[model samples]
Target: MTRGVGSMQDTFEKVIKHDELFHEEVLPRLKKLEEVQEEFRVEIGKITASQTSLELTVMKDGQQTRDLLGRFVDHYFGTDDKKLVLKEKVTLKQLSLRAKIALGFIGVLGGSGGILAGVAAVIEILKN
Candidate 1:
């Protein structure tokens, strides 16, 4: 009990003090950290789900968007799948590159006969 700094009793008391400090202070902070960590995990999960869906640019509601820009007004719980999905107020026309290129050519060309007449039919369909 009368020993100096090198005493075993002194080291033991220091250890107990540190332990009490951990229980009183560090434990509660650790608990709050766990809650924040869980929230981050949930947010990362949502981000991962969005990433997966974006790979195909398809929503659970059988609607597709552009692979790059994508489309949506907001997200909602789907009626069928009951999963989070984007609500689309607008649907972009999915056109083939060939059709788009052909349309460009047709736009450049004025009214004509023969082969142009066949293209005119396609243009009529594309216009809508």
Candidate 2:
């Protein structure tokens, strides 16, 4: 009975020693590991924020590029609105030059011929 009691006491002491060793050795290491894990989590959060900002920048740049391309096409290819404005300017300049040339030619016609030529030229322009 004494031997059996001594064996049980030895086993119980070993378990207590193991528990104490784990508390003394493993607990601090685990706490340090948790701190390191928290640092990694913080780093991951920062990386995520940076990635989000970069994505937004890329999206904005892409939108700007598209807008620039649209403007370039409108300028070069002449969208309908722009084409109408350009056509009006050209027509006005041509009409002014034609009127001047016709008046000069009528000057050469002389007297009543000049007046008749002027009227005819005006009528022709209006008809077109």
At residue 60, give the lDDT of candidate 1: 39
Supply the TM-score for candidate 2: 0.56
**Residue range 17-123, candidate 2, lDDT tens digits:** 99999999999999999999999999999999999999999999999999999999877877777888999778756776477557646654767577666776666
Error of 1 at 60 (Å): 11
Q: Residue 70 deviation, candidate 2, in Å?
A: 1.2
- What does candidate 1's lDDT look like per residue over 67-90, in tens digits? 322423232213433332222212
> Global lDDT for candidate 1?
0.65
- Model 1 residue 82 CA deviation in Å: 51
Please report, as a residue range, the 10-residue window in candidate 2 with the lowest summed lDDT. Answer: 99-108
* TM-score for each of the candidates: 0.40, 0.56
